[model samples]
Target: MTLPSRNIFRYKTETRQSMHSLSPFMSDDVVPGVNHSPVKAPRKVPRSPYKVLDAPALQDDFYLNLVDWSSHNVLAVGLGNCVYLWNACSSKVTKLCDLGVDDCVCSVGWAQRGTHLAVGTNNGKVQ
Candidate 1:
């Protein structure tokens, strides 16, 4: 017969002092130090991908958008079970369609007059 240890509940943290303690939103045209942070314009360097095809097995999968650039220029790549058709004006690399082996092509759209090529599958099958 020995059981008596249960009393630890202390709660008293009152901290509410803000009658505009030196501009804590007290505005009558406030600009004491001026630092709202917004004047950044000097970062332009991104132009080096006219063509760089080499997607072996390609299933990196970032929610799978799997490459697509066509307005008759054509690029559509979805690798794993094949769906490659890069033809930027006859730089040629066509193999389009092979979603076999239990399907793993993922996603590859190219039909805005590129003559239709919408293969997407991880067993979801878009074709």
Candidate 2:
């Protein structure tokens, strides 16, 4: 047996009434009948970096976080087995420590005071 044909595309009065009731809660700026246009000011931003620092032997592993910024505006980067600290104010790069050729740095983090730095190595050593 065949089922009776039904108009699936018939206009829904209930949907229209519900939407009309919610019109008061909706923003006037987004409604179709509203004429007001919001003005947005353009933001100014530099297209390129102001300064660039060369970091050699920086690891590209996604799981390893080899760089960290301290509260004192100092950036610590782990490159190979060596850890370097770059000061943003002076633009000076200082070699903090070297784990030697036998082991490579896995991660680096700065203490809350920004005075101490923690270095993690692939050989399960923290320096």
- Which candidate ranks first by TM-score, i.e. highest? 2
Error of 1 at 30 (Å): 86
Model 2 quality (TM-score): 0.67
User: Can you list the residue pairs that collide in candidate 2?
Assistant: none
Best by lDDT: 2
Regions more than 4 Å wrong, model 2: 1-40
Could you tell me which 10 consecutive residues in candidate 1 have the lowest summed lDDT? 5-14
Q: What is the C-alpha lDDT of each candidate?
A: 0.78, 0.85
Cα RMSD (angstroms) for every candidate in the order listed: 14.4, 5.5
Clashes (backbone N, CA, C under 3 Å), per candidate, total 0, 0
**Model 1, range 65-123, lDDT digits (tens) per residue?**
88999888878888888887888888888787787788778788877787887887888
Per-prediction TM-score to the true structure, in the order listed: 0.25, 0.67
Task: Flag regions of model 1 displaced more than 4 Å.
Answer: 1-50, 58-68, 72-74, 81-102, 113-117, 122-124
Model 2 lDDT at residue 3: 78
